[model samples]
Target: MSSLGRHHDPIVAIATAPGRGAVGIVRASGKQLQPLVDALIGAPLKPRQAHYGPFRDATGQPIDHGLALFFPAPNSYTGEAVLELQAHGGPVVLQLLLARCLEAGAGIGLRLAEPGEFTERAFLNDKLDLAQAEAVADLIDASTEAAARSASRSLGGAFSAEVEQLAERIVNLRMLVEATLDFPEEEIDFLEKADARGKLAAIRAAVDAVTARARQGALLREGLRVVLAGQPNVGKSSLLNALAGAELAIVTPIAGTTRDRVSETIQIEGVPLHITDTAGLRDDAEAGDEVERIGMARSWESIHSADAIVFLHDLTRLADADYQAADARIAQRLATADPARLLQVFNKADTGVSAGSDGRLLISARTGAGLEALRQALLKRAGWQAAPEGVFIARSRHVQALKQTAEHLAGAAAHASQADQALDLFAEELRLAHLALQSITGRFSADDLLGEIFSRFCIGK
Candidate 1:
């Protein structure tokens, strides 16, 4: 449904998950909620106070004993008068309370809230900006402790504050440039007097720093995609089980035991890493059956799309001629993959074989050796730095906006250094940069983008 037309109508919904709980809340937000409050409780509720009472239906029959809270307009979450009913945590009980609210509020056009309508209203009412509003959902959906903390910081306006500061600086420069353009007859070199070049340089540096931190935040939220691949029976499943600390995949001495990908998400230092163990890689001619060939085909596909690959090799089979030939062929094929994202690891290190220092990792999945190093290596590959304490949760779109701002700043710098001193071009570039920053805080956002962003949120929030 469109958020433009029906935002002013009174809305009510159960504010808790759809299940039995110790207590459930039926929340309503709109202007002039006093009538609805009186109809349900038979008395006017004091603003911002909770009163113990019984909710009643239209016929004055008690629905349930609960706490009623009333918040006057401009003092509530959605910047409107609000009412909350706390009742026993039963699905049927909550439904009854909700129906009662709708029935009693029918005169004021009260209706069920759409998904994310409440938070969208909060955003529209200036109770929260776009970034902070997004953090509300991020906090709820965070998969790691560090992620939750970072999202909390964002919700508290840490990220938005920084973006606003950057925007303010850009605005100051734009004003200086435009002022110089307006009064060219005043024989004064505005660029030299105001030190516009130095200020632009400083702003560029600040934008770069924010971009770096935002990339880290994005990494924490979306994690790296790692794929483990090797010949059959090369301890791929064992490594997966070890990383997840569970027997997620069947491990045996038989080849082609896994006919599909076994995926798991494991966190190292609060950074999530999604690891997928694919079927072993081998030639179709050596396949025992069509099923194995299909699995092997899938393995190659996983390897091609992976963000990182851990190529495991059996330590004991290094001397076997047939195994070496297959390994060489796989290595040749992997030559096309990204060298920065690939790691060659030798498994079964407990067999007492001397591991050479050829930049390959040696580990035994059984003994858990070198796994910590591997984890660190993956984090390094993903360019994760700084603890989550100093980082605020950010999405890929935020990163893209920051990058666009930087590019515009670069264009501004180029225009500033020209022989003719193209102040008009410089001012235009700064204006573009300012707009890029404004999008992050919803200052210049499109209505469709707002709809899309809020659509992902759960109902009643």
Candidate 2:
């Protein structure tokens, strides 16, 4: 839809879940909802007050007895005249109420709301900024308590406030730098006298602080994807069951017992870890049948895409030359792909097996020995320190924006530090940095970006 088209139409939707519940709500938003109120409820509604009544169809037949609420324009969620019919929480009942609303408001252009159209309207009407609009969806999808609280903080404008503050500093610095360019001959060094370099340094520091918090928030929103990969029968399934505290993956002594991926999500310190147990890697030609080959291929695929790969080494077989050769081959492939995300773990420590290298962690999945340390190691690899008291939830897009802003600031700093600095280049860098920061809060955003964001939200939100 065009920018103005969103505001021109009246929208209706079932605001509650589809299944049976205590109550269900059918909501309508438009320029004027008094007519709709009169049609559906057969009486006038007091603003912001719920009146117990019967919601009737076009024939004046009672569809459901419920509460009617009316919110006049500029005071409702969408900043428009809104009407809500709270009726019995049954699928058929809600459907009837929704249909009645469409029938009542048909002349006024009332149509079914698109996914996230309600929150999108809130954004367009200045009721909430882009960041806050996004937080509304994040708050709904939050999987952990920490994540929910963090999303709440973002919705409350904590994250946007920080971005605005950074933008203000950049604006001030740009103004100082631009002034120097406008009148080069004019006078006592404007930048030097005003301590422009000192201000730039301070802005850079602030960006770093916000970037750190944003990283933590992103971790909470998009938890680590950890893949357990190693040779066959190396206790990969056992380790998965131990971490999940459930027998999610089948365990057996037979080789190639797990021919597919077994996945589970578990939280440590309020940060989720999506763990996957995959078919073991092997070099032998006679390792498995056709199914096992496909499974191993999938295991490699998971490893390449994972945030972290736990290389489980059977400590008991460390002394065997064949096992050593196979491990060396796998290590070579990992080093070529992503060596930084790999964590060497020696399994079966309860059998008196020890790690050959100091960098590797020794753990016994059977007895749960060293499991806590393993959890901590996984968190460390994922770049999650801990869930701080006031951390906010952030998406990957937010993290990318912060990184881009930081890069621009770094460029600006470099230009500022030159002995024979170009003021124009420095000012341009600051402008770019400001724009990047603005993108986070949607001061400068594209229409397509907004569509992609709100498309993920549930309908009527």
Worst 10 residues of 1 by lDDT: 415-424
lDDT of 1 by residue, 251-285 (tens): 99998899889999999888889999999888888
- The TM-score of predicted model 1 comes to 0.95
Backbone clash pairs for candidate 1 read: none
Q: Pick the candidate with the highest lDDT.
A: 1
RMSD of each: 1.8, 1.7
Residue 61 C-alpha lDDT in model 1: 83
Model 1 segments more than 4 A misplaced = 288-294, 297-301
